[model samples]
Target: MLGIGVVASILGIAAGLLIDWFPVAASEEAKPIDTLWDVLIIASVPVFVGVSVVVLFSVVKFRMRPGEEELDGPPIHGNTKLEVVWTAIPAILLVGLCTYAFIVLTDVEKAQANTMEVRVVGEQFAWTFFYPGEDGKEISATELHLPIDRPVKFTLQAKDVLHDFWIPAFRMKKDAVPGINVTYRVTPNRLGEYPIVCAELCGLGHATMRATAVVQTEADFASWLEEAAKPPAPPAGGGGGDNGKGLFTSNGCGGCHTLADAGTNATVGPNLDEVLAGKDEAFIKTSIEDPSAEIANGYSDTMPKDYGQRLGADGVDALAKYLSEVTKEG
Candidate 1:
């Protein structure tokens, strides 16, 4: 039985090691974290096989038989050496694993020189990223963009409820708690687009809370940052087309509503294309500012009610006019 168990344990460990279980590693911090996971799997599989083997053997060998239904089996004392061996083995394994984990954590978290700071704000159903711009201003965007091979320190904040800022490829995550700030750091070593997900369930639209992280060449990143930092051009003829579209994209409206004009297909909220057809600008503006005034059929009042504050009067007017124009019936 011991030899059979050993063989099974070896096979299990090999299988665990061979399985590809993670997403692509895109950051410098991901390597050590992935290694830690592999180490855990290697250590855990043998213990799991040993336990299962013992349980199965006991069940087969010592289970009550038909003739022994009313019998109490022989009384047995606990084995002191066995008890100590099991306890001590687990204790030593835990201490070693924990010490290794601490070392990996410390290495990943060591602050690097010239780490760029990015502010991440999580609201119900949306994530907004802010990067420092020229002077004292900040450039805000719905998508996170990082320069490849640069260390980035993210300061996370939540406006309404708790949200977890997770980048799986980077293998780093932290919670954004309301009324406080949390931080984590990563250095992008790959040039690719990765997903940004809210690991916490914030609200009704929690599952829809998603964003993209783009790692770009340094020159491209610099160019994009400079362009994004510039003030938005005023809406043409008081908020009709391009500027309103920009607002829609930047504010993450596409994350909830299905807007054909904006090329968004998310249905967390109403289908703006169908619902807003023939609706006037006043109604649209009210819907944007006070979304809870009238709940749509088969939908909850989950829209954020701060568009009036987030986008000022002129901004709201522009967005209203834009939606009104795009969804207008002939």
Candidate 2:
């Protein structure tokens, strides 16, 4: 009966493991990582079942009957051989798993000669990607675009505080520590959009710290790189209104604040549409320049503090005016 139960448990667990447990395998690294995960599940389930069966069988077999309340159970001596076997088996299994994991990690992280580089910068609540362009210039973007099947290396730097760069589909993650640069490489095999998330808790806006990773065909990626490498357009409305919109998007405000005109729908902070509704230009300006001065109810002081310097007087004024105009009541 024990043997039959063990077999049933193993079969059941194996069936369960067949279910898709990860996002699509979109990278070369995904195959090995996934294989290791399956091995773990298969090995672990049997151990779990074996222990459960022993405990349950012992409970039922040694259970006291109604008429045996005064009886003393027989004492059993510990088996040194059994103890040694259990300990040695687990130790060997653990060493084997670790060794296999190390090999997988090593193989996945191997660098290629022609690997492209992208500088990833993580700040309070946003991710900025910089790619090498023509004439030693780097083009900056808020979204990450990668060519499918091309090995790309990410050089991560934190502007302030610690953050983590993680792409679930690619199954690669690395830390972004302040005053330090960390690097990780991945070769995307799937052509689709994926979310770039900060895996570490950095600050109030950490939850809202999100960005898009677009895996594109080589042709599309080349076109995007060409366009992005050009100089930016002039601010719309001539007063920097359009520039304000660009700033809002590039600076990562859309990741947390909801703004109708900008099409941002994040709820990590108070919705900018509602927060700015009926609010005056001065209030909106103050909010952007000194967000922590009067934080909206139910929102924390997660807004970046250096926007005033970063945007400059003209840009801040333009953003304030844009917000006021777009969010004003009819």
Candidate 3:
């Protein structure tokens, strides 16, 4: 039975190790994090299997017989040596795991020269990424873009409530506190796109508070940064289609909504083609200016409250009119 238990445990460990438990490891930190996770699984499997086997074997081998209702089982004294051995073993395992974890954390967060800084701001249901620009200015972007194989430091903050910045593929996460700035460093090793998830329960839109990070070659990243750093084009006459579209992108609306015309496919909010179907300009304006006044059937009241102030009356009306035209079904 002991031999069978050992074999089963080995098989279980092997199976667990073969499972792709996490997303693709796209950053340097992911190596140590994944290794630590595998080590934990290997160490835990034997203990779990041993305990389960012993309990089941004992229950079957020494359970009360059909006619032994009034009989009492023999009492056994506790073994001090066994107790000490179990306690010592667990203590040693815990200390080893903790030490390894700390080492990985330190290595990943170690500062490096020539690291670029990116400011990450978390609001109710959107993310705004700010990259350093020429002349000490900052370039704001709705999406995050980084150069592959380069160390990048992120300074995270929350505008309203607590939020967590997590990129599962990178195996790193940090909290974004309202009144505090938390920072972390990571080096993207692979060129790919990864989801940026809010691992904390921030508010009504907690589930939909999502974003993306794109890691590209150094040259492509530099080009993107240069383009993003350019000042916004002057508003067109009367704030209509083109002006409204620019406002929509500049204000970070594409981070949440699915608008085909705007090339935004985010699922955090209702699909504009469906939600704005047949709605008039006035109704669309109300929805944008005062989103909380009428919450969508499945969405939360997670829209930012300062849009009216940020975009002003003209911008809001233009956006409303633009959506009213673009989202109308034929």
Candidate 4:
């Protein structure tokens, strides 16, 4: 019995050590919270082995012996001493593990120094990130970029419905609420590109709504920020107004809904300037009313299908006409 126990115990410890590799493959974070997971696994293994070994021993030793099938074994009542031992041991083990988990959570939640602030607004099937540049000037973009090895604090908000901003490699996520802002922080130690996926289901195109998170060096980030701040050149032709703004909105236009003069910086919809360039009146009108008939690549068909109902004939006509004239070539 002594030899069996010794060999089994050594094998059990080796098995536990050998299998410590995480199946999740997200070992990169190495945040203090992840250490709690290791603690839980380590503390539970010995208990698990004890249970299994006892069950196997009982099966082998107490199987129906000769003439034992028709006879009752000696009746033995539960021992209070044994009960106290098992109960107290498990309680102490649980208390210790729970205390460690709480401490880790608290540590990971502590705010860090020099964290970059970004307001993440989640819309149906898309994520729009806004960073306030110098002097309270803001930059809006679709794709996310972060400076490597810096702490980033994200303020999450939802425009229409609930969405979860999750980056698997970072092992962090937060819920975007429509009326309120939820905040979380993460420090990315590694420099690489990773996919930012929405874990929550929002609407029809939920499955297809995805974006990239480019972790760049500090120098690259400074360049990107500068370029975003510079104003675009005015259109060669006159830009539309006097409800040309509404014309822009109803068309579901703007690089990202911005009122850029002619440039499409963040346009998820049709770039009025680009799409209508060299086009005549008739083609532009047809394209607006029947958009799916001409889908734009790199964007989903999330444009309201009931535009014809909401806009009426006159609205669509004016929008297309405005687009055609202003976007005309030299």
Candidate 5:
């Protein structure tokens, strides 16, 4: 016990000192989480090193020799003191950790006055961000834009399967499950573009499920929000279209199609604007609702089998009409 304590203390002290020597950049809102992690490491390191040293010592000292294999070992006996010590210590430590983690989680997610509200909806392979536009109406899109230094409250929910929303630099992540809404807050300290990865494997195309989160100055974010609020620019022919066109990355259309106008870089599908340029509303609607009915030139039949069900009749109608209007004439 004395040896174990000395070794553990020495190793832990060395590591702690090394870590302290490095500079750590703290987040504006993640301070509470960082503090929680620090406490856990302090409490855990000694216990971890002590157990490891003890295990190694036992392995080396009690290792069976070649001649000892045929002989029976001494009668095994359990030590009450050792068992009680392990049990009680682990229980107490776990309880403490749970308490501190819960406090940090709740404190970080608590609503703050003047916090920005954005609705984050996730589907099988896409994410849509919604902001309150003029008249307090909702405007939806595929990209995420947040103002730096301001707390952004995200109301996260799933439209289809389960997906996790994570921004590593911000140190905040939460699951978006169907039928339940999860919330988290982030105050982006940096002004740059970061990738939003789906940490949860929702389906086959999970590997390609990604979006960009742009953190800009307050003025830039405000201007971007205003631009996103404007009605989605007409597609091609002047007519009604789906309102959800704000940002639809899930259709895997981005995987094969190239719609430069929509900022979609997907090369899996045909150039949408070029393909739909001269097509009438019926032609475009049929192609989207019944994609396999007429494959868009070089694209496959994987353009979301249930887009009709996912977006519904009105959504399909608007999208088809919008496509017809937006597709540039060949």
Candidate 6:
């Protein structure tokens, strides 16, 4: 029985180690997290095999024969030593695993020198990343960008409901509470793009709340940051299709509205292509400024109502004009 259990444990551990279970580890913290997961598998498989082996052995060895159906089995007594051993072993294992987990958590979350701070804001259905820019202003973008090998401390905030910011490759996640800020840190060690998701269900658009994290070379990140900090050039002839599209993306409009022209297929809110097809520029402008004024059919009034203040009159006019033209043309 012991021999069978040992072989089963070995096979189980080997299989567990061999299987690819997680996405690519893209952050320095991911290595230790992955190692902890392996340790858990290693420690767990043997116990599992032991329990399964004992149960099977007892069933096979102590089975009642057909002739003994009317006879009672001999009385069984509890072994105090065995009980103590089982309890102590599991307690020890639990303590050891918890200590190791705590150590790993501390190591990953240790504050490092020269850590960059990035502000992350979560709304009903979108994520906005804010990086420190020149003159103390923040450069906001819908996508997240970080430099490889640099530690980034994200300050997470939610404008409306609760949200969770998660990067699978980084192996770190934190909730964006509505009234307070939550923070987490990660050091990007790989230069690649990874998906950023809202792990918390915020509202009707919770599933569509997604973004991308781009881990880039230091030089490339710096160049991108500098360019993003610069004010966008006014659209030629005031507000045109290109400018409107930029506004739509930057403001996270496409996160809840489907727009064929913008290539966004989100359905959290009304489909802009259909809704704005026959609507005039004035109607589109009103929709942008005050989304609650007229709720679209089959959708909640969850669209942010501060766009009038977020985007000035000229900006709103540009977006409305762009939407009006694009929907009509399509």
Report the C-alpha lDDT of model 3 over 93-209, residue by residue, as the tens digit.
999989988998898899998899998988766677888777776677767999999999999988778889999999999899988999999999999899999899876556767
Tens-digit lDDT string for candidate 4 (33-135): 5566656656776677677778888899988978777987889999999999999999999898888877766665678889899888776556767788777
lDDT of 6 by residue, 82-169 (tens): 9999899999999999999999999999999989999998876678788877777667767799999999999999876799999999
The most accurate candidate by TM-score is: 1
Clashes of each: 0, 0, 0, 5, 16, 0
Poorly placed runs, candidate 1 (over 4 Å): 232-243, 250-252, 305-315
In candidate 3, how many Å is residue 282 off?
A: 3.7
Off by over 4 Å in 2: 63-78, 202-207, 232-242, 277-280, 295-306, 309-315, 328-330
Candidate that beats the other on lDDT, 2 or 6, i.e. the better one: 6
Q: Assess every candidate by TM-score.
A: 0.90, 0.84, 0.81, 0.59, 0.74, 0.81
lDDT of 5 by residue, 1-330 (tens): 667777777678667745743223223656676667677777888887788777888899989999897888789799999999989999999998998899888777777677898888777666777787777667766788998888888999887788999876667888999999898887777778878878998875565668888989999988888887777532321111245344344444554556765566655556777777887888877777778887655556766666666566666677676667666455
Q: How close is candidate 2 to the true structure, as a TM-score?
A: 0.84
lDDT per model vs. reference: 0.86, 0.82, 0.82, 0.66, 0.72, 0.86
- The residue-by-residue lDDT of candidate 1 on 70-106, one tens digit each, is 9997899999999999999999999999999999999
RMSD of each: 3.5, 4.2, 4.4, 9.2, 5.3, 4.8
Q: What is the lDDT of residue 59 in candidate 2?
A: 93
Which is superior by TM-score, 2 or 6? Answer: 2
- lDDT of each residue in 135-239, candidate 2, tens digit only: 776777778999999999999998778999999888889999989889999999999999889999987667889889999999999999888777553332121
lDDT of 5 at 117: 89
Q: Cα lDDT of model 1 overall?
A: 0.86
